[model samples]
Target: MLHSIRAIVNGSTNFILTKMFDENLGFKEALLLAQQLGFAESNPTLDVEGFDALNKWTIFLCHAYGIVTTPDQILFTGIQNIHKSDALVAKARGQQIRLVAQAKKLVDGGVAAFVLPQFVLADNPLSFVKNEYNGVVIESGFADQQFFYGKGAGSFPTASAVLSDLSALRYGYKYEYKKLYHHEPNQLNDDIYLRVYVSFTDVKNIPTEDFEWIEQWHAQEDRKYLSGVIALKKLKTTIWWKENGTSLILEPDPIIENIEVRKLKKKAWNWLDYCRINLI
Candidate 1:
């Protein structure tokens, strides 16, 4: 049998809502059920990685533009790799990290969607959005830009948004959601700080040739300690070994090319594990 409901009403949308059904059920499971019921999709990537913000943005685009598109066509990035050290530095510098999902209408009658992590200065409105809160900014030629902010995730929050959409649909509002091919890839440009640990067989023979661009702040050869920051452009290659214990912090060069940041993240994670640093 096939069944459809306008929408479900709820109070809170926190993880607790999923827990009420099954102790082991999670947000992904609940979303999967909704997808199977034709209410959503099995977008494990977004639900697990927080790119669901982009999914919500895609729905909004369809409503505003009278067309259809999927979040897959948009640029996406998640904060799953952001380390505690980076967060600490951001806090020290009076900054906060935010998951920003955006959609823009191009001047030439095109649309764009993107989901990425951003470091917002303390003064930005985005910085004020705390955990699980969602905010959107809309722009149009006829009307001034509009901003909407509210509880973005959780079962109750999503239910509210769905109910609102259902109401519009019942009033004869018709919208088409479509999937489009996104040919344009997103290029990430940002400053990243990485903490690393290193060890060398012969401390005296350690080559500084590969790290000429790295700024050495302090070193203690007796304890085999080397901590510094290197510009991403200066990194020619990285070699790792279990025996060579090392610790260092690096900043991405302003113009880094030919390397995926994910590789750097893996290296950092390994170093952290070796150093027995608590990544969490």
Candidate 2:
């Protein structure tokens, strides 16, 4: 009903991640099976790395807001770099690591959109969607939450969509663009602050001054979790942890407050499951 929509527009990566998390399969194994089962292409460069989703996002924008853009114009990240350790970390916290592609209207009359990897809490309906399925959430004034979940991959599915398009043509029907003027997509961290879980092998390489505050952290010899709230703009430019094999997931909410590093242990559950108040 609303002009704005948020959707997970990919199927191969969804299926692979589903297999990796729900079925407990490795990335390689899940990818191989996806290709074998016709869920993925022989050369799955687009699907696995998120280019496919980027394309779908571009299409969505064209129809939803009458804005047309290219893949290079948007912020995009894929699931190719997701490691088993990352999945295990999310699983330990009762979360699902999902490669979510999101597009929505911002409060400032601009659009905030991106396709990237994010951690979904167990309570979210998106976490329950698995395999070659897609979950799309449309939020607006009249319709607060509209979720569309179904099989979104395979040759049959693709053909069915193609046929539907053809059938619409027979009826002299076409998608109408509600918006033709385009504005620059808002960069992350501009006006919105997100709670991110950043993991790295070494803490020395992290930039401590960029975040407004460090809520909590978990330190391990080879793995660490730095939980903090930061602007989306600052986060893109301050990815120093990647050189040290760092991975990040945006939290759904900011729960923890100012936490001291001394209280962090080598292994602890989420910020909620661990000690909220630092005793030391």
Candidate 3:
């Protein structure tokens, strides 16, 4: 649909995450299983590294909103860093991890897109999208929410898609590109903020000072987890998140409002104030 807000289009990463979440398999183990089952490739860099989803998101951008963008132009992260511990924590919290490629039309007529592993709440439809199934949830202002799901990978789906394309061509079908020709495409915006979860072996690897807000945190003997709000721009520009065995994932419904950002910043400041006074 023309007003589609978000689309999760990749199945390889989804299958891996599904295995990790449902079967408690580690990343590499799940990946190997996927490769064995034809869900993934011998070289899974494109799928597990988020490039495949990034490319698919760009195509969705062009088709849905007439916005032309490349994978390099957007911020993306993959499931490679996900560990069994992360999956355990998520399962304990009744959430599932999924690689989601989503874009939203902002109030300022700009668009923001990301391909990243996200925590899906139990009630979210994405939580049920397991194995090699792909699911897309499109939120439209006028039509409410619509969801589509199907096999997104493997030889059968690929062959079916090719045959469908041939059939469409034989029937003289064509994409109107109405959004591109008749409507003004929105520009990609990186000025927004997202609530994120980061698990790391060392706090030094995390840029805590850059956080607009931190809602929760925990430290165990082996690992530490922090939940915070950060600028999308910072994520795009910084390399800290990719280093030293750090894993970052977005919370379910990661986007937050500017007013909420300000309020959380104030709360974080108050928390620091209490910490400074030893009032805990």
Local accuracy of candidate 1 as per-residue lDDT tens digits, 149-196: 666555676688799899998899855433223333222222322223
Per-residue accuracy of model 2 over 159-259 as CA lDDT, tens digit each: 99999999999999977665554533333213445567777776777787777557777785466778876666665565463455566666754222223
Compared with the true structure, what per-residue lDDT tens digits does model 3 show for residues 1-280? 3344555578888889889888888889999999999999999999898988898888788878888888889999888899888999898998988888898877655788888888889988878888899999888877788788999989999889999999999999997776688888778877789999999998978879998878889986488899989999889899788788789999988986565677777888988899989966
lDDT of each prediction vs. the true structure? 0.42, 0.72, 0.85
lDDT of 2 at 210: 76
Candidate 3, number of clashes: 0
Candidate with best lDDT: 3
Descending-lDDT candidate ranking = 3, 2, 1
All predictions: root-mean-square deviation over Cα?
A: 14.1, 6.4, 2.0
Model 1: residue 252 alpha-carbon error in angstroms: 15
Span of ten consecutive residues with least summed lDDT in model 1: 1-10
Candidate 1 Cα outliers beyond 4 Å, as residue runs: 1-45, 61-69, 103-112, 138-146, 166-171, 175-280
TM-score on alpha carbons, each prediction = 0.43, 0.77, 0.93
Better of 1 and 2 by lDDT: 2
Q: Which residue pairs overlap in candidate 2's backbone?
A: 188-232, 188-233, 189-231, 189-232, 189-233
